[model samples]
Target: MKSELQVFQDYIRGRELRRTPERERILQEVFEIHGHFDVDGLYLQLRQKGVKVSKASIYRALPLFIDCGLVREVDFSEGHWHYEHIYGHSHHNHLRCLGCGDIREFENPALDHLEEQLAREYGYHIKGHHLQVEGYCPGCRQAGAFPAESNFLAKDSNDQ
Candidate 1:
């Protein structure tokens, strides 16, 4: 398998975009994060490391990374989007806890079968899919973490 830097460099060259140290630094920081992250948090992380990268540069590079299939955007119903590097990772879905805003990754062959069936039935070519099952986790349910009305309305800062 090709390294992330090699894949990114190939993509940049194909698109005729310059390969700058700043963009490479941003890419390194992005892949270093194991979990979900937003642009503002990424900016802070790079700044703390004394990397002189502007958030604007990060903003510009993100679309390129996504286009190259090196990164993907995930939404947890928060106001903003979070990103994760998908290179060298297997496909999976998310199980989100509404009460505590915790996210769990899960994989199942059944989902893959369903996608195949749907594609054949509809005669549509499927690229990929995102499935997020939302509910209270065991700990949250046992602790009664939700409000009286509904837990679905709960939104937290840690909703990744």
Candidate 2:
């Protein structure tokens, strides 16, 4: 696997931008996390490492990374967008907890079959699909984490 730095370097090269130490540093930090991070979070991490970079620089560089197909943008309903390294991986859907903000990745053959069947029935060719399920997680439910009439919530409400 190409290091994230190498990926970023290639991106800069393809864009005809001269490679700089600051760009390398930023890419290194982003690659190390390899998870969701917003612009402010990335800036804070770089600052913690004594890297003096402006927020605007990181923001501008992110789109370049995206354009280069080295990163992906994810919206987790947290009122902020996050980015992750794509690394030439196949697509997968996300399951998220609306209350706890926990995210899980899953692949379902049944869902795939359903999409294919629907496409065939409609006389259309399937190209791609994105499915996201968001709800309270089991732990959240057990803890009465959401405002609903779940069994745990009912028990607690009855006790009260």
Candidate 3:
């Protein structure tokens, strides 16, 4: 398997874009992170490492990374987007805690079967899919982490 930097270099060359040290540094930092992260968190990490990368550079590089299949965007309904590097990883889904903002990664063979069934039934070419299941985690529920007002279902349900 090619290293992230090599893959990125190939991608940059293929696109006729210049490969800069800043982009390489950004890629290094991105892969160093093991979990979900937003731009602000990424910027802070880079700064702490004494890398002089700007947020604008990060913003511009993100799309390129996504295009090259090195990264993917994940939304936890946190208003801003979070990103995770997907290179060298198998597909998985997320279970997120609405109360404490915790995330757990899981894989199910049933989803693969369902995807295949759907493709066969609909006659559609399937590429990929993302799933994020959200609810209060066990600890959050036990601790009563967030108030009812934070629960959109409680606020919006007619049954309430």
For model 2, residues 1-160, the per-residue Cα lDDT tens digits are 8776777787788879988887677777887885678889999999998999999889878887887777778888778888877676666788999778888888888888998899989998887676779877889988988975567644554367
Q: Tens-digit lDDT track for model 3 on 31-77?
A: 99999899999999999989998999999999999999999999989
CA lDDT, candidate 1, residue 82 = 89
The alpha-carbon RMSD values of the candidates against the true structure, listed in the order shown, are 5.5, 5.1, 3.7
For model 2, what is the alpha-carbon lDDT of residue 149? 57
Best by lDDT: 3
Candidates ranked by lDDT: 3, 1, 2
TM-scores of the candidates in the order shown: 0.90, 0.75, 0.90
lDDT of 1 by residue, 42-113 (tens): 999999999988889999999999999999999999888888899999999999999989999999999999
For model 1, the stretches where C-alpha displacement exceeds 4 angstroms are 148-160
Candidate 2 least-lDDT 10 residues: 149-158
* TM-score, candidate number 2: 0.75
* Count of backbone clashes, every candidate in sequence: 0, 0, 0
